[model samples]
Target chain A: MAIDWGFALRIAGFGLLLVFSILALLIVITRVVTRFASKKGPEEKEKKEERE
Target chain B: MIDYQTGFTGLTYGHIILICVGLIFIYLAITKKWEPYELLPIGVGLILANMPYTGLLLTPEQAGGVPGVAGLLGIFLEFGLYKYTVLPLLIFLGLGAMTDFGPLLASPKGFVLGAAAQMGIFVAFFGALALGFWGIADFGIKEAACIGIIGGADGPTTIFLTAKLAPELMGITAVAAYSYMAMVAIIQPPIVRALISEKERKIYMKPQLRAVSQREKIIFPIAVMLIVILLVPRAAPLVGMFMFGNLLRESGVVDRLSDTAQGALINTITIVLMLCIGASMSAELVMRPETLMVLGLGLVAFAAGTAGGVLLGKLVSRLSKEPFNPILGAAGVSAVPMAARVAQHIGQKANPRNFLLMHAMGPNVAGVIGSAVIAGVFLGILG
Candidate 1:
């Protein structure tokens, strides 16, 4: 009829995946933003100077 | 002759009430100028679907085709389109063509918010399961997954997956998903504010400085498709169709196909889909306590997704040196520009100078792909 134990384990496994993936997701997002923000720093200064 | 009196009963009253609701949607679409492109059609569709004894909405009259019974739309749904799984797939092609992955490519980090928002999907799954365990919702595994995706809040994606995977629940899922997307401009604002301090909401995100090259644009969807395919092949029908549509736009070789997909194809599918979905709402099927539960769960799912994105967003703000407005996080639910607009509106309330609409779109679009990937993952394991 039903594979109760298997189904429970799979749900449990997915829950863990969501948690670990979210942590990994935050790490990746932080790195990318910092990379882009740093890359554009000089250009931002140049624009500010031009405007002033 | 038609037995008009006998054919309609309890459903007649319920449908009349829903028609009034549709009228309100029509008012919102027209006078309020709210999401007119889709709301008007969906409103009329809701009315058409709810009307009882309207043969046009039934399943072809069981081959009797008696003069006064079960008009053409019903028969078509039973045999022609959904049963054959044609329209939903084609609709994905058009959606792909219309979508520009530029925002997503410009800020790959937005995928995290997209992923973050999907926490709503899984959370809603558990919520739906809880509802079932409570005997509040009559959902099993597949139906719960389909319903939970209302958190992803993209219409075609919701329709595509729900149609193929769980047709019976389509009416509730579509109504809840689209309605919530429309109301995101309303529901998400408060949640976003509470989660993010005004200072975080007021923070400005610098625009992506690099110009995305056309060559890269063309290559983008292909790369995404490859990764998604490796992860979840079952989602290929939707993902492949979406990427193919985007490819048509980016390829520069298929202007005609791209134009048709963006314009003619979307219009036709929109009409067919709305009507087909509406037709499924026969009174007995839709008025149950379970249907109400599905609707309630969908709202909770969308709100949870929005909150989850903002929470992660606040975390990102702290972790980064530059100020990142956590309001943009709520846009991670993928109502496209609508979710982003809410972010823009709320961000401006806190700081008039902040312009986060485009920034918000990065995660908004990413949420779309995230949900598709999640759908694929589920399909990979279950179906």
Candidate 2:
């Protein structure tokens, strides 16, 4: 009985950790990409400045 | 010799009760648009299963599920659903085709929320174990694992895993998974609202500036599937079907097959599976006090899972300089866009400018992959 419960918790924790870490990594990548895409140019910012 | 003038009308109360229940399912599908995906087929199958002397459930000759003979659908329940494990796989393939992994690929960090959301799965599993100790369903480690995935709120994954690990509980587990996913629109809004303030909801997301090429879309699924599937073969049945459907979608050549998989195949399978499920819910089998226990534990599991995801969101927000609205954490239950939308809706209500949907999708889709991985891991650990 003790073994069954411990096994359940371990399996559960492993499942949660595996999925959550991957999701967190996906977010970090998206943030990095967002920063990269936004750095396209001062000129792009200037063009928008003119419009505003 | 007896004065029995029976036609299609059911012969006994057991027969009549189940037959009518089946017909009602059909009516709900045709008229109510109530989970048309599975309800229609289930309704039809249920009607067939319930009819007296139709013998939808096969039993030992002496056992009395349908008296003397087995019906056509009974064979399907036995061979097609139980024996071959064909229907759940097909459903997953269709779900994969319908799903767009673009949002997930674009923002991979969303995977964390997906993972965090699965805390609910483990919580649910532990809950099941406790319930088992307290004398719940004939639930063992594997059975508890199957039941716990319901917190993932992913029907295909739940069914796929459970149908393999604990076929006896498929009826309850599948229905619970779908029911929760469907109600996610209703259940999650309050939870999202409770967690985040108005300012957070109104945050606007800048438009996705980069163009996603067709090649990238096609290659991503194949590569990811290869990486994940090769690593965890147990995950292949669910992941493989999902990826194959996605490949079919992105291939741009198999529109016909994709359409059929997404529409016809899914519809047909859903109908059959739902009926097979409802048929499993016979008065003798389902109408027990333990069902309430199952439902109560399900709610607890969902609530705990939501809390876990949101708490992780809070942690991420605290750790990052850029504010990460923890409301998105509640969206991690893999109810797909529904949970994500709730997070978005709640965020907007708090801060009318905050756009949490795209952010939430990261976790939402992550939740999908997360659920699959968790299922794979569970299957692996148990195996």
Candidate 3:
């Protein structure tokens, strides 16, 4: 059977674009969650500062 | 009574060559300590598999209608690898238990570097297709996709993808991936140096990372699972198990379970998985010219991955207001701590006071997730 170059190229393009988009979304979500969790109490802020 | 022949009756040049290859793997494992856990067992398996008429591994005819009389290694390959796909996912569980997402949580930019590094996968994919198109090799889309994942520098991911797309090439791909991972210390430096300038390597970031709270730590895995699975439901098997293992570690309530998952469970699974993978490498299977080509293409993929990560690091460093050492970018190839250590070593060589271990780890861990996500993408499209 002959190899389908076009389909393979499409797989590459779509797979990469999907990976980047999902990871980017993850970064955004993580930042938001961490920010909210930190804002809940000054004790948390103090602990974070101490650790740093 | 005199019909008995020696076990070496059917041995040939192919068997000798494969035996020698197995010996080389053993030598590397013992002397150089190159992924000894994997290579040693794999070496032993290869030796056994190549021994003529040992019946250690069942032939297809033997397995077809045999009842309670199957080759030991054949059983492992069929059940552990092809039939159930259990070992790789279990390994991910251990990896998750062993991993601490603290660094990644502290510096989220590592996620971007991690994603960027997966460019190696696509680059190799394209290369394989081009080779196939030109009749240089017979790499179809499935074969090309499996070969490309070796660049991910994640062993379980490589095995998982290969199992799904090209089980025929499993032994070689696993060997290539682990071998490159073992040599990350050597293969990465020159490429990183070529891509990153001396000043960029010496660029110092503060050592302090924000401490993640227990609550956030507990929530991280759940959040990751929800988002990732929602985005690509096909990732559930690998990513879901990984997150579950992390949750066990971070939950603090399941210490015993977490310890076993990371320690005994993982080690046991590693032995079985590596041995079975090795046993699959019979002379007739791996002695082809295509095997050599796959090995060469695997190297190309790895180098491309490192280059991709380093190049992205340079780009991110240029754009961001904060000083970013481009060398940390090389850590995005997901060889776990080794790749990160290479980044740290390169950084320290440039400047004595510079410490990039923790910084590099951000991307190092992120690379793990990135590779899995890419694996999911491939499975989504191809599987």
Candidate 4:
């Protein structure tokens, strides 16, 4: 069988793009959710309450 | 005059060599404590499969003519791997259940390191193609892809991908993946040291991570599952089960089920999966030029992965205002806590104040998800 170098390169290139894109999306979601829902650590809570 | 048949008479040099190899694996597992969970069972299976006149490798149909069959490892190979590919995915489920996503959630940037480490996969993919292009080995693109995934430093991912694309290469790839995983302590330090300077290794960030809420923990797996699977639906079997397992752990609602998935279920699947992988390595199948090339390429992939992670680690460190150790990038190859532990070990060696374990884990677990995503990509394109 004739090896298709073009297709092989495409799989390598596109596959990586897809992996990066998906994980990047996960990171974005994580950052957004944590910003909204993450519980402030004790240190942060104490300082914020003192300021209030 | 009736005579009883014996395996001793049928045994050849190939069987003897494989038996010796199996003995070596057993010795390493027992004495050195090297991946004993996987190596011990695989060693026993290797010995059993290579024994002449043993029907352990025979399919039920192949052994039907015989009055009775004792060695039935072949059944696992037929159904668990080739036909259904259930065992590896189940192992992923158990792994997910056991994993704590806190580190990853606490430090989202680890996700990028995890993705960067996967560069080794494509490196090996292209390397295999080049070798084949030159008529050096009989590797097609599918075979190259299987060989390439070993760089992911994930045993189950390698098994899952290989079984899907090229079952013939499954045993070799699995053994390579686990063996390299066991050698993470040995493999990663040199690559990390070479790439990272002593000053960078000494860089210390605060040990305390931002507290992730119970709500955030619960939302993570569900969110990841939906986003990843929607984009790469082919990953459903792996990512779906992995996220489901994590949900069982993080949800705080199904302790009993989660306990079973993490403990009993994973242990059972590991035994069956490792043994079948060992049984597949008959001498004729393993003793080849291509096998040697694949092994070499696997090492390259692993090293490349570590390099890729560290390079990205350097870049991320440069960009961030906080101090970050590039050595943590080495953990992005996804050998689990071992790779993370190696980062911590190397960091402390450089400076006692450095505590990179929690930070390293962010990339460590992300490597798992990243590899699975790549596996899905391979399956989507090639399968």
**Which ranking of candidates, highest TM-score first?**
4, 3, 1, 2
Q: Rank the candidates by DockQ, best first.
A: 4, 3, 2, 1
Question: Compared with the true structure, what per-residue lDDT tens digits does model 1 show for residues B227-335?
Answer: 5665567778778888899999999999999999999988887777766666666555676787888888889889999998998888877887767788878988988
Best by DockQ: 4
- Cα lDDT, model 3, residue B8: 76
TM-score of chain A, cand. 3: 0.67
Stretches of candidate 1 exceeding 4 Å from the true structure = A1-52, B1-11, B64-70, B79-81, B207-209
TM-score of chain B of each: 0.91, 0.87, 0.97, 0.97
- Point out where model 2 deviates above 4 Å: A1-3, A21-52, B2-33, B43-48, B59-70, B207-210, B321-323
Docking class of 3: medium
- The most accurate candidate by lDDT is 4
Docking model 4 quality class: medium
- Give the TM-score of each candidate: 0.85, 0.83, 0.95, 0.96
lDDT of 4 by residue, B72-164 (tens): 798888889988999999999999999888989999999999999999999999899889888999999999999999999999999999999
Error of 4 at B289 (Å): 1.5
Give the Å error, residue B268, model 3: 0.5
Of 2 and 3, the candidate ahead on lDDT is 3
- Clashing pairs in model 1? B55-B70, B55-B71, B56-B71, B58-B74, B60-B75
List model 4 lDDT by residue over A1-52, tens digit each: 3589899989988888988898899999999889888998789899999999
